[model samples]
Target: MSSTLIPPSCGRAIAVRAGGLVEVVDVEGSQVGDLWAIDVADPRRWLSTSHTRDTLEQLFPRVGQSFVDQRYQPILELVADTSPGLHDMLFPACNPALYAREGSPQHPNCADNFVAAAGQAGVTLPAVPDPVNLFQNSAPDADGRIAVHAAITRPGDRVRLRALRDITLVLTACAVDFWPTNGERCTSLRLDQLDGDGN
Candidate 1:
């Protein structure tokens, strides 16, 4: 198994072979991480949150379920999750524009982090899609009001994912300090790229 640590307000991209597992660890409680992936074989058919939601007919991710692409192709599988399972797929990745709207024009965000991570992975895309906000606590009420709150993930909690195809994985240590998204503070994350089976 290989591991990488993503510091607070930073991002990193890695290649996950088919059948390989990527483990994301909540080093400290109340931290959120953005997870995005694109298939190397077909870039145009990247991971689609809408498709996944429709496929599962659910909003939140579940263990033993695969996150699919726009073409309904499996990309990554949520093999295990130890957190509170309150991740969000409805919200877009945090970006500078979002911060600017909130009165913080120069705040660091996940959109820029994805670009940097993609560059390091030697891959490019036409647009940045909404990522799976790991450890995030977002709930929608009966009236359709979504409230974002502090994460419930405890220290050392982990979420494991399995790659269903050759793909590039990008992760960002969410830097949203202006809200309770990161408990009003940013923190580091740990990513472990585990070998397949006996390899």
Candidate 2:
């Protein structure tokens, strides 16, 4: 197992070897970390939020449990469980259009992070797909309105990933100025590898 700390409002790219585990810790409460997983070799077939959410629904993760994406297969396990609240199943990674819609004139969005990470790994691609928003909550209302709210994760909460293939994990601690106190500005995080025993 290996461990590293990511400072608040920053991003980190991690490469996970085949059969290895990657654990993301939300050291500070209310921090939002945008996450994306890509096969180091293929780079195209990356983490799918729809697939992940379906797996989570099947496993029924409860409070204090961890979700596992085994063999990149359809069935994910709830090795350790945690409570579910306003988890977003359809939200995609931030893109230029999204930024523009949100009234931000920023060129670099979450897609930029993925592209940058891939470039750093010597991979080239025209575009990266949508990514998963970990520790963030966006709920939709009956009239089809999306409401962004504070994160439901508390300090020390974490999400664990078990690699099904040799993959790269790209993450950016979001620093949305509108939500200054969400812990993204100066949050702390710890990453650790899991043993075969799933501990």
Candidate 3:
């Protein structure tokens, strides 16, 4: 197994072979990580939040749930989720526009991170899709308004994903300090790529 440490307020892209397992660890409590997966041979066919939500018919996926792309093809499966299940799919990845809208014009964000990570992997596209906000605390209220809260994850809390196909997984340690989505402080994370035998 190989492990990679993503520095705080940064992003990274990892190539996971088929049948391999990728584990994302929250090095510290209260940090959120934005996750995305792209088909290695076809970058356009990437993880789709809308399609996943439509296929599952649920806002948040459960353990053992498979995440699909825009074509409804399975990409990665959520083998395990140890957090309190407070993730968010409604909120788009944090970007410069979002920061400007929030009255912060020059803040680092996940959108840039996605681009940087993908670029590092030699894939450059005009735009990246919205990501699955892992470890984030947000849910719709009774009136359907999304309520953001602090993360419930403790240090060492993590989630495991199984790759169904050759894919590049991108992650950003979401640098959103303006909101409680990241507990108002961002932290680093760890990613481990394990073989089928859990090596």
Q: Across residues 112-145, which tens digit of lDDT does each residue of candidate 3 receive?
A: 9999999999877768798999988887889987
The alpha-carbon deviation from the true structure for residue 21 of candidate 2, after best TM-score superposition, in angstroms, is 1.6
Q: Model 2, clash count?
A: 10
Please rank every candidate by lDDT, starting with the best.
1, 3, 2
Rank all candidate structures by their TM-score, best first, as comma-separated numbers: 1, 3, 2
lDDT of 2 by residue, 1-199 (tens): 6776756655667777776766777886777667766767676566666555566663224434333332345222223424244344466666678768878867445566666756776666556655556666776678988777777677788766666667777776665545533533546667677777656
Q: After superposition, how far is residue 185 of candidate 2 from its true place, in Å?
A: 4.7
Worst 10 residues of 1 by lDDT: 190-199
Looking at model 2, report the run of 10 residues with the lowest lDDT sum.
74-83
Give per-model TM-scores. Answer: 0.96, 0.74, 0.96
Model 1, C-alpha of 183: deviation from truth (Å): 0.9
Clash list (residue pairs), candidate 3: none
* Model 2 bad stretches (over 4 Å): 50-78, 81-86, 96-108, 180-186
- Indicate the TM-score of model 3: 0.96
Estimate every model's Cα lDDT from 0 to 1: 0.89, 0.61, 0.88
On the 0 to 100 scale, the lDDT of residue 89 in model 2 is 45
Per-residue lDDT over 10-95 for candidate 1, one digit per residue giving the tens place of the 0 to 100 score: 99999988888989999988999999989988777778899999999999668999899998888999999988788989999988
